[model samples]
Target: MNLSPLQAISPVDGRYRNTTQDLAQYFSEYGLIKYRVFVEIEYFIALCDINLPGLTAFDKANYNKLREVYLNFGETDAQEIKDTEKVTNHDVKAVEYFIKKKFDDLGFPDFKEFIHFGLTSQDINNTAIPYTFKLALNEVYYPKISSLIEKLKELATAWKDVPLLAHTHGQPASPTKLGKEFLVFAERLEIQLNSLKTIPNNAKFGGATGNFNAHHIAYPATNWVDFSNNFVNNTLGLNRAQHTTQIEHYDQFAAQCDALKRINNIIIDLDRDIWTYISKNYFKQKIKEGEVGSSAMPHKVNPIDFENAEGNAGLANALFEFFAAKLPISRLQRDLTDSTVLRNVGVPMAHTVISISSTLKGLNKILLNEEVITADLENNWAVVAEAIQTILRREAYPNPYEALKDLTRTNQKITADTMAVFIDGLKISAALKEELKQITPYNYTGVF
Candidate 1:
């Protein structure tokens, strides 16, 4: 059968294709090929800039043309490399041959040999993958995350004064402002985002065994170690791992994955809270016409967007955990395990993007049920026990905790009138009584 969304195996590429389409520029097969070409071209330029003995003879004016190989790279260029890969049976080698073919086409036959120079597949893979991630983070991930945070901030400010009955252990406890609840998420996300920023986009760039053996042997007089460091760090905008085996250490990469997982976990927490609030009628969704919330029951507007966000966040976290745990480990020096695993780096991120989109949708559809929130707060006059007990203690009342506990724990429903009557019978002064009477759930939200 022809390729269809239903026919695809992974939902990232299938069911949520539109939500994750931007990931294709960073994590797809073509993206990998393009990055490999980018690394190769950049490395060649770095070599030229180093003023290597043989490279000094090349025409510096053609540098723009040289960069065009990658800058203007397209599907046809990718197909050409794939064709070459069929002959070479090695992906990185195909990139080398494709660059050489480009040089030959441009009549720079002497420069062809320097295309790949002394590099291994992991050298290209490590640099290319991290470079892709750095660009994607700057261009895609950060923007999306920033947008989500901004949306959260907008909601927080919009609902700042709105009082919400706080729930602790699934029971109404105290009162908190709705905006403050959203600010909690905004704060958590900002902290994680700062942590994410601290994680360096590192890459390995030494020779086959990360020893620079070929570079050393080829030009013993040249400081190839320093050269590799400068090329990886200065030219490519990645931190250079000085010591390694055949591949990158992946410790930093793992840290990044864990960071993303933590951020997603925070979003998951927010999703669950929002879902609970929706269930409690603290939030009512803006229902669309002809949309059925439940098939059997006509009166239903489910929190499916938050549910979808939660489910996708869980999937993203699972994959991110695997990446964090598995990528950093390999049989001494090198292994092929990381190669296949690295291909799916975008999968978790794609799911994260989907979750973010779903969450934004959920936030937009929510219509805060202010009447229900106010009614709940007004009815739960028992929440004021904490304040009353504190005031009682201030007046040197004996066993204030026991007094409030006895008054609140019974089967009687606590209301504003009942609390006022109880306060009127207290042994405290009339001034204290009046002060206590002024405390209502609506105005009892401790701080802004």
Candidate 2:
């Protein structure tokens, strides 16, 4: 049985492989191994730069060669590390062995022992994962989100003056410009995205028990705390958690997940609203030839893109919820719960990527049915009752609300003509009557 899309379990890696291929460089097993290699090599270089007593004998000229082991790491290197893991029975230990093998190959065997000195698996895992996430956010996720935002902005500007009948409690109540409604989503996404930017890509770097217990024991004279902080903050470009158990506190990571969830939630809201608009005939989809909308009905052009986006967004939010709620709660010192869960960090992000792609597709398919929108507003003349009554009140017309209510209610099909005729018969002055008559559903929209 050869590997195929059908053979894979998760849809993100399987059915939707093309949609999420970019994430593989940051979240795949190969990506993880490569990141581990990067961290190990960087740690070794940092130690050498610190000019530790025992490590001072290494050749400075060979530093570039040592860095190349990871800089040019490939599938063969990753597979070699996996093979080493089989013997060591520890992932990080395997990385250390792999680096030692590289050093031996490069004729710097004496410097091999310092490859991963005084570091726990979490130290490697924490830094590598967050670094991968940070790069992925900058390289992949942020671009997709920004593209979606730009698409929404374009639609907002394009449809700024296109009137849409507003629905309140499932009934037509007023009218609003279609573009302004899109701007609402753009505003929501921008705020949440800014918050995500503020969340520091934090990582854990202390030794076994969140304190550099072993490092401090090995070199009592060195300021291990300052060293750890600098290595994590300056070298890796991540925020260092000064105090912790064996793992990162994940508070900031949880903050990031929650923020992503909120953004996905907003997309879900947009999906549902757009789906409703499609259903109400305010929008029609530009169909692709040979695409099936339904198995049974031939006269169907369903909003599957929005539906697909909604479903994927829901799945992403569920995983994000678990990540936010569960990752931050571990037993007293440390636990293995977060380890397994953290590996799937890319799952929610993959789903989010899928949803964003689907949403973009949906946005492209939509062709605004302006005629239907205007017709809906023109037919719902009773909506302007509020506007007319307010003006009547301003003119000191007694019983204005009661009069409009009587005229609108029990009149199942109110039209612009009916409202105009009724306004002309009002006892108010001709000027007030003309003002009331001028108020149509189209112009009754509060503000564009």
Candidate 3:
């Protein structure tokens, strides 16, 4: 059968392809191959810049021509590399050969040997993977997360004055501003996202076994370490791991995984809260004309968007947890386990994109059911008992805590009139009684 979205085995490419397709440029097979080619070409160009032996005679004008090998890279170029991979049984080796072929075609055949010279497969894989991951976050993931945060801020600002009956351990506890609640999530997400940005995109580039074994043996007098540092750091804009085995240590990458998992966890928390709000009629979803919430139910507008976001964020977090725990450890110097696992880095990323988009969609659809929110505040007048008790404590009222607890902690419903009657019965000044009676769920919401 022909390849299509429907034929994809993973939902990232299948069920939610449209939501995640933007990531294909960074995480797809073609994307990796293209980056590998780019790294090889740039490494060769870097060698030429250093006037490394025979490369000194190479024409500087052909640098752009060399860059075009990857700048103009397409599916056909990737397929050519894949076909070469089938013949060589090595992915990075195929990339090297492909670049050599490009050199021959571009009339720089004599200098072709310098492409990916003295490098192990991990060198290309590590550098190319991190570079692509960095670009993906900067170009795609960060923007999506920022959009969600901005949406939360916008909602928070809009609802800043609206009072909500805050729940503690599934019971009404105090009144809080609706906007303040939204701002809490916005602040949490922004802080985590800032932390995530601080982790450097690191890559291992010191040839086989990370000692420049081949490059150093070929030129014993040259400082390969400094050369690699300049190439990886300056040319590629990535941090080079100073010490390593066959592959990168993945410590920073693991930290990134943990950070992303934290962000997804926050999204999950927001999803559950909004879902609960919908359930309690504090918010209503803006329904389309013909949309059906459930097949069996005729009158239902379920919080499916939040549910979708929660489910996808959970899946992303699970993969992120595994990556954080697994990628940082390998048997001794190297192992094949991380190689296959690294390929799926895009899976969790794609899911995260889906979740963020779903969350934005859910946020857009929500309409504040102000009447219900107001009614809830009115019905939960017992929440004002805390304010009254605190004020009474300031006034040095005898047994104020016990008094409010006795009045609130009972089967008897606490109402405005009940609070007023209790306040009138208090053995305090008439002015103090008026101050206590003024406390209500509506205006008793604490400051942000």
Candidate 4:
């Protein structure tokens, strides 16, 4: 029972470990502990900068030495903290003791007491969690999403001129460019992404119970609010939540979750559409020499890639929804509910990464069946009836909609020849009849 990828309980660490291992640096236990140590060290440095009482005369030359506690943090350092956690039974306090131990080893025993002075565990946990989350998005999540969008744009641009029989209400309605359809999802994703960027990576920094209870009591004359703001914002590059309970209000965090869910939803939409396209033979998946689509069906080249993306997107969104709904609520000034839930923040993100990667793989494998796409357009010539009818309306033709409806709905197979015959039979002038006859599914894709 040694620890290995196969022994992991969650698929993020088990089956898809390689796909999501990049996130381990942000949301793993070691990542959180490392962040806690970082925040404590930086807080001590910030106190030195402010010339806070006894800490004012602290040596500036040891700043880099203090930073090295977390900068050179590694598996050994993490193991030491975990070992410390075993003794203290408090994760953040373990980080405090670990940093103090590092200070003691650095021969700065007098400076060790200020490592976590006047702060509750939440101050460390909340700040470290948000900071880690923000860095994960900037360093990992956003880049993945942007890469997907860029892939979509490439395909959309490549297929911009290809006409597709558009489906509305489960019926062929009009002709649209294949690229325009993809652009819809791309545009939607980009909009939500812009909004996601605006949301502050906020953290709860007050000592305990939302007020600087310990902070104010320790230094009554000092402006702890402004000090906390500067430390959280300028020092840590995160927004300080002005009001809170024992933890962050999580309103902005919930907003971030909702925004990620929105992006996942857009990918889900694209997955279903591409799956349908593959089903309809508009896309033929590239087959590996020995790949099996199904064990029983020898000829099946199924749309499994899009299906995988869709399934993972669904899972990601579900967890993201829970994060949005559950993180923003607590019993009172504090509760233990969000603690365990927050630990899984990387789970949804990992799934999202796997899903998007699947989607990209699916997109790359698609060999467009132009023959099938064009044949579909040809078979659905009845779609041109709208264009003809609209033109007839412009010409003041009597009952144009009724006329096209009667002509198209009778179901005598609205092929090219039949459409031509119907156009020739119209009471309009020959020139107008010829003009109406020119409308076809291929040429009817409107301008962008």
The candidate that achieves the highest TM-score relative to the unseen native structure: 3
As for lDDT, the candidate ahead, 3 or 4, is 3
Candidates sorted by TM-score, best first: 3, 4, 1, 2
What C-alpha lDDT, on a 0 to 100 scale, does residue 230 get in candidate 3? 99
Task: Estimate TM-scores for all models.
Answer: 0.98, 0.97, 0.99, 0.98
* Model 4 segments more than 4 A misplaced: none
Better model by lDDT: candidate 2 vs candidate 3: 3
Quote the RMSD, in angstroms, for model 2.
1.4
Clashing pairs in 1: none
Better of 3 and 4 by TM-score: 3
RMSD of each: 1.3, 1.4, 0.8, 1.1
Model 1 segments beyond 4 Å from truth?
A: 1-6
Tens-place lDDT digits, model 2, residues 1-448: 6678788899998999999989999898899989999999889888888888789887677778877887899999898989988998888888888888888988888778788899999999999999999998999999999999999999999999887788989988877889999999999999999999999999998888888888988989999888888989999999999888899999999999999999999999999999999999999999888898889999999899999999999999999999999999989989999988988999999999999999999998999998899889878889999999899899898999999899889746888888888888888888888878888887776766
lDDT of 4 by residue, 118-178 (tens): 8888889889999999999999988988998998899999999999989998899899999
lDDT of each: 0.91, 0.90, 0.93, 0.90
After the best TM-score superposition of candidate 1, give how far the Cα of residue 147 lies from its true spot, in angstroms.
1.1
Relative to the true structure, candidate 3 reaches a TM of 0.99
The sequence of per-residue lDDT tens digits that candidate 3 reaches over residues 1-448 is 6689889999999999999988999899999999999999899999999999989999899888888889999999999999999999999999999989887888888888888889999999999999999999999999999999999999999999999999999999799999999999999999999999999999999887889999988988889999999999999999999999999999999999999999999999999999999999999989899899888888898888889999999999999999999998999889989989999989999999999999999999999999999999889889999999899899888899999999998999999999999999999999998888878999998876
